[model samples]
Target: MVLVYGHRGAMGYAPENTIPSFRLALEMGVDGVELDVHMTRDGEVVVIHDFTVDRTTNGHGYVKDLALSEVRRLRVKHGFGGKWGPVGVPTLEEVFREFGGRTRFKIEIKRGGDYYPGIERKVVDLIRRYGVNAQVVSFDFDAIRTVRELDPNIETGIIFIGRIRWFLDIARKLRVRWLHVSQDLVDPEGIEEAHRSGFLVGVWTVNDGEVARRLVSMGVDDITTNYPDIIIKAIRGA
Candidate 1:
C-alpha cells in the first residue's frame, strides 16, 4: 500500500505547520505528516514553511532574523480562509515531544539565502532524543549530506521541484534511500527506474482524486497532499 502523508499537516483544512494542523491530520488517519523546519535567530529549530513569516502568519519578518519568542507571538493565518483562532508556530522540539512514536515524520530542512549552519545537528539530536520514526529531507543537497554525516542512522531524502537525472547520483553519494519528486514529474517508468536503482519514490502536493489514483496505479511509494482524508479515500476506493 502507498503511504499517505499530510502535506504540512492537512493544510487544506488548517494553517500549514501549526500544531492544530498536525493534530487534524493525525485525527484523519494519515500514515505520516510532512513539515518544514528552519533555525531561528537564537538557534532554535522552528517549524514554519517559508523563510519569512509574512505568508502564513500575522507578523512580517524574515524567520532567520526573528527569535523564537518573536515567532511564537505571531498567529498563523488559515490557508483556506476562515477565522480560525490564533495558532502559534511550533518548535521542532515541541512537535517531537507531542507526536513522537505516534506516526512517521518527514522533516524537510529549509534554507533561505544561506544554509543554517548547525541546523542539521540540532534536528538529528531531537530525533534521537525523542526516538521518533522520522526522516530528514531537503532541496539542499549539502544539507541532506550534512544530515547523513551527523547521523547515518537517521534516514534522509532529496526533494526537487522538477525531474532531474543527477538526483539519483546525488542520492547515492549521500546514501539517501528516498527521492521526493514533484507530482507532475512522476510516472510508471520513472518510478520503475527509481525502484531499480533501489530508491523509494514519494511525490508531493497531490490533491486531485483522479491524480492520486493514477499515481497509485503508477506505483508511487508515498503520496503527500494537503488533504489526507481525500487521498485515503481515493486509495481505499471509497
Candidate 2:
C-alpha cells in the first residue's frame, strides 16, 4: 500500500491532534498518524503541532511553559459548524496507551531552545516503550540520533523543506532512509534525487486529488494529509 498518514489526526475533519481527529483517521483506515509534541513546563510530553496552544485552544502562552495539568485543562477549538469537545491536550504516554499497537505514529518533537533538556531522551523512551519503530518524524537530527542510539531499528525520518539537495546531503550523511518534505515545496527532481539515492520520499499536508495523483506518478511513497479520506480516495481512484 502507498501509506496514507493522517496529518495532525485529520486536521480538516476535527481539531488537530485530538482524540476525535485520531478516531476519524482510524475510522478512515489511515496507515499512520503524524503528530507534533512539546515538553510542558513540568516535563510531560504533550501532543500538539504548534509550539503554543494559543491558536488551537482557548489559551494564551507557549506550550513549553505550561504544565501538563494546564495543558489538559485547555480546550481544543473547533471551527464554525464543527463539534467542540473537551479533547484536552493528551500526553504522549496516554496517546500511546490508547493507540500504540493499533496505529502507527510519526512523532515530531518540537525544539524549545534549551528550555527543556533530556526531552529527546524521554520522547525516545516512549517510542521505545511502545515498540513501534518506523513510527516517528522530526526535523531535528539530534532527536533522530537519540532515538537511533536507543533502538537502531526504529524508523525515523529527518524532516526538511524548501530545497532538495539541502536535505538530500544531510540524509545521505545521517543514514536517513526517509525524506519527509512539504508537498508544495517538493518537486519531481527532489523526489527523483532521493529515490535515486535509495531513500523513501514522503510529502505532507496534501489534500487535493490532482496533486496527490501527480505526486504518486512521481513515485512518492507516503502522502500525509489533513484529509485522509480525500487522499485515500485519490490514491484508490475512488
Model 2, 37-119: lDDT tens per residue?
A: 88888888888878889888889899878988888888887783546546678888988888878888888876632556777
C-alpha lDDT of candidate 2 relative to the true structure: 0.81
**What TM-score, to 2 decimals, does candidate 2 have?**
0.93
After TM-score superposition, the amount by which residue 124's alpha carbon in candidate 1 deviates from its true location, in angstroms, is: 0.3
Per-prediction RMSD in angstroms? Answer: 1.6, 1.8
List TM-scores for all candidates, in order.
0.95, 0.93
How would you encode candidate 1's per-residue C-alpha lDDT over 65-180 as one tens digit per residue?
Answer: 99899998998877565656768999999998888899999999986225676888899999999999998899898888888887999988999876635477877888998999
| Model 1, residue 47: C-alpha shift (Å) | 0.5
List the candidate 1 regions with Cα displacement exceeding 4 Å.
Answer: 79-83, 112-114
Among the numbered candidates, top lDDT falls to 1
Q: After superposition, how far is residue 155 of candidate 1 from its true place, in Å?
A: 0.9
